[model samples]
Target: MQPAPDRLSDRRFAAIAHFVEGSVGIKLPPSKRIMVEGRLRRRVRALGLSGLDDYAAHLFDRGALGAEAEHLVDCVTTNKTDFFREPAHFDFLRGTAVPRLVGQRTDRTLKVWSSASSIGAEAYTIAMVLQDMVAAGARFHFSVLGTDVSRPVLEQARAAVYAEAMVEPVPAAMRQRYLMPSRAAGDARVRIVPELRRLVQFHSLNLMDPSYPFDRDVDVIFCRNVLIYFDAPTQAAVVERLAGHLRPGGYLILGHSESMAGNGLPGLTSILPTIYRREA
Candidate 1:
């Protein structure tokens, strides 16, 4: 006889939801139950658990899920990203931010952090822009740090490969300068050119942490599209943390849909649709 089909019950869903929010700061409301169930069923099968309820029980079973916490966080988090997903932000960085940095700073080293970089696309995009600036006589050596909560995406981001279709938004000149066609048999992919790849570093980061692990303030931070997944309070907390990682007068770029209207964050002034600056 076949095994019984797993059903993610309301109670079980609530438990999983609580775990996710508490662990990662993502708000998975009741409406996401179905989506959560669909994504988590793979975990159930992989672990050879009896069903969704069993999986939930295991998760809460007195530290039984110890090291599995990272995996659970990975399974629940969304890692959707693309090269130049939001073009305007890149344009702003290239045109406004870089120029100001180059003219103002006596030091020629520029640092940028993509706080929620999904698969390295955004970081690499920043790299390409900086490279273009360097080619055009900008006197700065750029460094980009791409961070995410998901280990899988961080690995992918470090690998720096993407499907051809995903590279569509990358400008032709940039595609030529920074991407190399994958030569792997039957794989129509492109890898970030080594020069650009060397400019970026990837690491795992959980936004829920009380503080970030950075030792130096960066010139710019790209944290777009991540705040929407968090509740208002979480959004505010995260924005505050991100702001602390920026230098005075540095820029903070959020998603177009996210706002700091009630965040009570001090020292950040709105500059554009979703752009803010740390008061110098």
Candidate 2:
């Protein structure tokens, strides 16, 4: 009988689950065994291994994990993203937050961080808002920083290209202004304009880290949607760390579903259901 190449032995699944949860704080319960096995196949091919069994052997018996773990983590990280996702946040950012942040700023450039910025959508969305603010004569310069744990997504974010369908949520006017449609015939794709691209930067960061390697005085941080994957303790620690990065009176915006994020956390005021302001 041909081997079931994608299947993982129960022992191998436990080991992989432990490693994944420890390294990245993402749970890989027994229910996720199928998902993890499927995702690990990418690394199996990348390493020229025969199958998941061989991949597990390579990681455990051969001790190849230290060198290959990043690739392994990249495969498993969920990077669901879209342009202008959760439009209400952007509306609040533009209509209320920016003006207030500007009013309180001492620096010329407002720094915006998209923590967990999968493929740059959230960060670029922020850049578009700030650019529009300046274009509409709101007096302040702005720069956006996009950070994610996955190296592959950061590379894609830096590339600044997307399928046309992926950009559908971007309004028509912003599309015309900020996206350069692919010139190649029949290529239904677009790349963000260089001007907007220049305003945003992508970096690799793990929210599980003890400390983030970035500025502490960020004006606003969009850490939406990514926290739900973590256990409660991890979520709280990450939230506190993110709060530490905010300037006093700066904002930390969680996803709509994460409205309870800052509950009982110090120096944070729940300004909106999911929006918390750091104490000044």
Candidate 3:
């Protein structure tokens, strides 16, 4: 039997670390070295490479390997988000954030950003909520934008297709209103209705960049469960970039387990548990 490959030789590990840090500002911990190695082992074998070192060399030597590098990053990075994953954040947006902002607004439009939206669920959820709010005499124009570093996932988000299981938690009434069931090649799939798709957009964004652009001021930013992957310094940088896009008096929602206390955004005020407001 072939000997097991060396997962983390100093050179190969450094290359992987540099790729992730440069691309997404995420610093993979030493604890994850073996985990990354294990995940990529199969890919190396499939490529007819002998070990991690061989694969890393190929990644650097070939231009076509860029896509594979991206695939590796996507595979290693965590993307465990779901629709309405953090119910309280959505609740605060519907109950307090929207009403408070609308009361003070000169215009009816509300712009929201999902800073690390994965697979479009979070953005779609926001759209669904806004649709309900609009139907209930809440006359508001809304746009939900989702941004992520993973190109593959962003493509999936743009496609707006999902397994039926993904919609299970979505309220039946809303599901009926927003999703259409269809048979594609004899397999059933749920597609986001044109109305919801029109309200949301997805883009590729690198959070580490100091000068991130927002097309318009954002009223609510849903950046949940994404910051835990970064180091303290990177986290602080990301928070600052995200805060720059939020409209005054708008809200920035973080993961239930994440905090912005030490990241230096004093303008943020905790309004409802995990929900925070950007002071006007």
Residues 134-208, candidate 3, lDDT per residue (tens digit)?
998897889999999889899999999888888888889998999888766765679899988999999888787
Measured over all alpha carbons after superposition, the RMSD of each candidate to the real structure, in angstroms, is: 2.0, 1.3, 2.3
Position 81, candidate 3: lDDT: 69
Steric clash pairs (candidate 3): none
Q: Which segments of candidate 2 are over 4 A away from where they belong?
A: 1-5
1-280 in candidate 1: lDDT tens per residue?
A: 9976667778878877888899888888988877888888898899998778888888886465767788887888888888887788988998999888778868878899999998998899889988998998878898999999998899999999899999999999999999999788989899998888988999888999998898457899988888888888888888888888888878889888885632347989888868888886
Better of 2 and 3 by TM-score: 2
**What is the descending lDDT order?**
2, 1, 3
Provide the lowest-lDDT 10-residue window in model 1.
Answer: 256-265
Which residue pairs in candidate 2 collide? none
> Using alpha carbons, what is the TM-score of model 1?
0.94
Q: Model 2: per-residue lDDT, tens digit, 1-280? A: 9855569999998998888889989888898888888888877887889999889899899999998899888887789998888898999989998898888756767899999998999999999888988999999998999999998899999999999999998889999999999999999999999999999999989999999989999989999988888889999999999999999889999998888978889999998899999997
lDDT scores in order:
0.86, 0.90, 0.82
Error of 3 at 112 (Å): 0.5
